[model samples]
Target: MLQQRQDVINHLAETPFWSLIKFYMDDEIVATDRKKKSGMDLIKIIQCYDSKQQKFKFGDHEPKAITSEDVVEIFGLNNQGVELPNTDKSTKNMKDSFVKAYFAKQKIGKKNDIVEAYQKLVQDKTPEGAKATASIICVHLLQSLLFATFGTYIAWSFITICGALDQISKYNWAKGVTDYLFKRINKSKKKRKNGEESATINGCIALILYWICLHTNLLETISGRENMIPAIGRWDITKIHKAIRDIRVEEIEISGRIPCVEPNESIGRGIPCSEEPTEEHSNINQEECNDIPYPEQNNESSKKKENKTTGRKRKRTEVRVEEDQSITITEA
Candidate 1:
């Protein structure tokens, strides 16, 4: 008898939907106090059994429909197997609605808000897009800064006058800087060759390139020196270069001036200076000579030229009228 009862318990657990149907049928028999019923009553019972069987097989949960409370209990959110309190009535109602909708399609009996609650919990655990992006950038920035600083120091020490200059013969300060930058670049390239993903190294390379462009005056041809500093600090060399180039083009368009060419283009060229006019009435006068032909020249040089040029010349002659109606020209 004990073995038989154990078998029944195991069978009931395996087919919980059928056990529920049997319980409902027994309830109907007891309610009517009838041992036997009509064909229509028997057909209704069979229909219930078939419907429950289909629902149990195709529903989201098998054997028995799992509830939100079950999940909460599993997660240790609720102690002593107690149901959690509904703090937000509207949220509870929304959850209840989703559960009812899901179960109704499967012909399974609804448990209030179970499916909705589970979905909400899953959504709450997901990270926001902006926050994730920021995290990625922060990690990359940290890695890049570490490696680049290391490379910079190595380069600085190796090429300095205090260090072994004989080991790297025919080297200048610029060459030392370039060599340091290339070492970082080649390291990054090797990582890529080895199929390693290193966002930090990439960020470091970008910063190093931007620094090189700024120091070598490559940024000036693309953007004014004033805007270059901010652009380079962003740690994205491509973006910095693009922004500089756009600003330069805009300034050139507004000022009707030619865009500055690369530093290499002006290499070995003389440092430009304005010619002083020999006479006050000379066509190449102070004002004309004071206007720097290269608008991209630094403001200090331009300001000095403007002041010297203006101070070297006298004011224009003023015409004076006499009281006797005769016009008298006087130096004013």
Candidate 2:
């Protein structure tokens, strides 16, 4: 069972997605205490993002141009693989097969549903359960973190990759995410320019935020800067100030920090889920839950739970993604 869990989790670490895991494991990755992203001033920075200029105009900071190489470094995604196939838009076969395999085909689940299912399975103490748990996690993260802001129903399209985990490494997921982010940036910028009041520009805000900081000379270095490739692991946020409306730059401290009404929960603690569910949560049939947070990051050699026999196996599906960074699975 332990090996099974390790194998499942390892498949994820092997993907570009692992960069996100490293990003969320805040305290450990930064090797520091109290690194706050709450006052990130994320919106202002993103709104200032000039895709045409390939730059971000942060407050009064010099507008720095971000290169493709910069984006690759920020997200730490592999640009080597073929692009993800356009399945979500291509056909329903992959999602249908996934729905049939993991949950009720008619259930039409959401991100929270995937989380509840994961909590229920991690305790099953079996290889099959571990596999199921990891599969659900891949889909959940692909939606919430990467292709976030996709409407309510689970983006069933990503489930296609769970079986072909090995092939997932072949997809240029980094480029896919970068493209997705740029598309969203353009859309958001265009809307706001047209006088749209909504400040919500989706996609990987954290990734974009870090990408901006990477090209700018604002942050102190991460402890092991020479070795860490991912931007999230290399930038120190604690050395910065909290602000609103406009964020000051170049180490200039504000007269007084802006009063931020924030939750007592640490920003690094993980997503602000509606409620916390423990490992012993016993709601297997429950179809709703708070958005799933990143799985606790652990070493591959970490211990696993006691044995609970594996569950029944269903027919597996193998699929590929399109240029959109996803693929469809047609049973061979």
Candidate 3:
């Protein structure tokens, strides 16, 4: 059972989709318990936004802007790929093809049907099955967290993409989300101009809140463990809500620049501040494909095991003068 578990871990480690999420999260059980949710301040912030210029015009005096670059930086999603195919007929075709290949019926049963289907596939214990499992987890993470909307139903865009999950990283997922947010932000500004009451400010609203948490000092926030990727999944919604509760949009202020909200430094008043940027703006180190930590042991024994196995490899040369051949043994 222990070895089998390691097999699953290593199998998933090599899979591209698994590597993609692990690049950001590198953890299990990222969810937090919550009694409250956040984003009142985010809604208020958007109220002051001018979509034409893509700037947050607090008044005629001070205006600060956010960009798509900021969104991609915080979320750490794929920055380049083919743009998402968004058409009714395309989604319909994807659903038809997916169900026919995987399910007994003409369509998927309901919400989470894909999850059910994924669970079944992994039961076969094949490499393909293991890869399929990783794809589902990756795709679902994108849907529920980054590109999410308010619905019990899954979007057809994601559903269609599931058919080619091996190449999932080839879709410009970050572009899809950033595009949606720009549209939503523009819609929001237009609505308030027409005296429309506060509507459902859609498309990953919490993301903007978290991004603002870095820029302003109004909200109480936590700087996560040093060097860990800023997986938005790690956010505590209730904490965000409590911090900004009872605060009006009129009182909000900007203390840090956008697209560079540093967490390592004391960048702003509330959250962690920006660094001098030793690294490039890009988050993922594409060359380092094998960063996933092995779960071969539990917390009780992991340290000793890690030191014994995962530490630096040493090269040793042995001379066999008595024989014709000299042998070299390298540490694994």
Runs off by more than 4 Å, candidate 1:
1-171, 199-332
Runs of candidate 2 with Cα error greater than 4 angstroms are: 1-4, 19-27, 30-40, 51-54, 57-68, 86-96, 103-109, 124-128, 150-154, 237-332
Give the 10-residue window scoring lowest on summed lDDT in candidate 1.
292-301
Name the better of 1 and 2 by TM-score. 2
Candidate 2: lDDT over CA atoms? 0.47
Per-candidate TM equals 0.19, 0.61, 0.60
Instruction: Kindly list the per-residue Cα lDDT of model 3 for residues 1-332, writing each as its tens digit.
Output: 21254445564454333433454333331212222222333445566767777667653436766555555655555567798776112334524555455544524222356556655655657766665555455545554445544332345556657656555667766677767766766765566557654433445555566565656654433345222334333333333443344344444556633332346543323332322112222111111111122221011112221111122111222210101011111112
Clashes of each: 2, 14, 3
Query: Which numbered prediction scores highest in lDDT against the true structure?
Result: 2
lDDT of each: 0.24, 0.47, 0.44
Best by TM-score: 2
Candidate 2 residue-wise lDDT, 1-332, digit = tens: 32346755665677666666545533234212121122134444555667787566545655664445655786576777677776234333534544565566434555556666667766766666656666677676666556655343434456566544555677777777767667767776676567764434445555654654554433434545744666655753322222121233332122222222234555332222232222232111111122344432111111221211111112223321111112122223
- Once fitted onto the true fold, the runs of candidate 3 whose alpha carbons sit more than 4 angstroms away are 1-20, 23-33, 59-62, 87-90, 94-99, 103-110, 185-198, 217-227, 231-237, 254-332
Model 3, residue pairs in steric clash: 262-273, 262-274, 267-273
TM-score of 1: 0.19
